[model samples]
Target: MLITDRHGRILIQRVDYRTTCLLPGGAVDADESPAQCAARELQEELGVTTTVDRGLAVDWVSADCLNAPASMRFPGEILHVYDGGTWDDEQIAAIRLPDREITSVEFVEPARLPGLMAPGDARRALSALRARINAAGPALLENGLPIAPTVLDRALRTARARHHLPFHVGPVPEQLSVVQVWGWLLAPDGRVLVLLEPDTGAALLPGGTPEPPDRGDPFITLRREVCEEAAAEFGEPLFLGHLCEPDNPYARLRYAAPLTRLGPPPVDPATGRTHIRILATPEQALELFDWGLPATDQLTAVHQARARLGIPRAARQPLTELPDATDLTTM
Candidate 1:
């Protein structure tokens, strides 16, 4: 069972006998199906009753893969990884553990699984997580390795290296000044444009600080910066919201606009670097930003803005280079 909390932390169980922790599951019984066994195990072990409808991954483990005690002979088995579903605070509080076998359960960040579990377990957990985000159904694994990985699985590491920035999103404070501006510049398909730094894999949206020539208008700053950095033009802009950081006097403004025209990639005069432009779904963009759980709120805002704009939700696809000479007038 691959269980996660609302914050995307995985549920791990520690056993009395094993040095390494395990995901919350056990051996299957003869009369129970895999899904039934998963539910029954949860009830017996954690005293929680929940439906297990989604299968995240299936792996075939051979006998040679097991590390068994000399007294116990190991046989190969087919393992099924089921979606335990996301648990809220109330549901999590109701969990009860059996006294003998399972010692404790902890919700851990995906990045910490490597240090906490065996290599195979860690790999399977990560692959399962990526599959969930992919929203493309379950994946197939062999001994915990993805046989055919998704785009995110190939490019994104479970232990995503991210820089933590204190950020809060809401209406811009009346008294606070605007320091920087960024836009969720959307294409016809509702995918947002993101600028990627080739050297660091860092991603950012188009827009930047207001320039002296802009006369202090944030919209002017966004227009100038988008053209300079992305070689793109956008139609009328819609104010999405602003983000504030503690002790910072200036608020970072965010907007959404339909991309009008995209020219060939050009060297940004301000930074002298040509960033790789990518169009990603909102979910994929959140992973690329690597802002942890708070990103969910930002995503909600994004979807709300999308609704107001009447843009269709973009389907999940592998990250690809944004093509130049694209025309959205037809859309």
Candidate 2:
């Protein structure tokens, strides 16, 4: 199992009898699958319970290639690596170590893995890390298998680029008038709720600029704007962070989540703006935005939300024409 924190730091454990560290996983019991073993071992060794998702990587290690002592070497083994989703500081702090076996647990930066683990183990960990990175972007898979060196290299490049990328919203301008907030309102069927501007037939997330009554809280602003613009009530918004262009520093790109539509949408009063919402798959949404005036920041925010929610990237394809705009005025 490959466990990590929100910051992408890998969680490694030091065995009581070993000098090299390994991930929090062990041999599967007779009745357990690899995924079951991963989750059970995590809680037994680390004191936290987490879901073990699908395999990230599967590696066949030959007995001759093993880095352990000759006496301890066994037959070749096939390892099933699963993703132990990101945890926070509180979860890390709550770890309960079984001193008899797991001596210590610590999160280590991926760059330092070479010095901390055995060569073979380090290679496995690095492969798992790359898989996690690729999970955040467009993944390269063929015939149910990930392309070897290319996928790994692409993931490494993405990870390096993201580490250096700036994600900050610039200094607040004195005359900043509107703090715009939006929602990536997801449905159970994996469709995203979007709004269409009636006048220009432009696509937008279901949100708008904050009004005076918003009380300066972005969450509050989001709730109000979503209701006013979409005529549908949403649950409390989870802040997904911000996006901003260098030239438009005052145009804040705030997103919220756990979006639940309470009822049927009523027609919006705002002139030239359609209240009719569009439920599009992530791929369709991308194409729709491409056909209209693209809101790059909104698209970025959508990707961020998807990453946080563990949603896979949609496969890209060309569309000859855009979908018909939904007209709220007729509703």
Q: Cα lDDT of all candidates, in order?
A: 0.79, 0.60
lDDT of 1 by residue, 155-191 (tens): 3343445534444556777888998998988788888
> TM-score, each model?
0.77, 0.47
Candidate 2 — which pairs collide?
A: 238-257
Which ranges of candidate 1 are over 4 A from the true structure? 62-64, 69-76, 155-171, 174-180, 194-217, 220-233, 260-280, 283-297, 314-331
In model 2, the runs with Cα more than 4 Å from the true position are 67-75, 136-147, 154-331
User: Which candidate comes out best when scored by TM-score?
Assistant: 1
Error of 2 at 155 (Å): 5.0
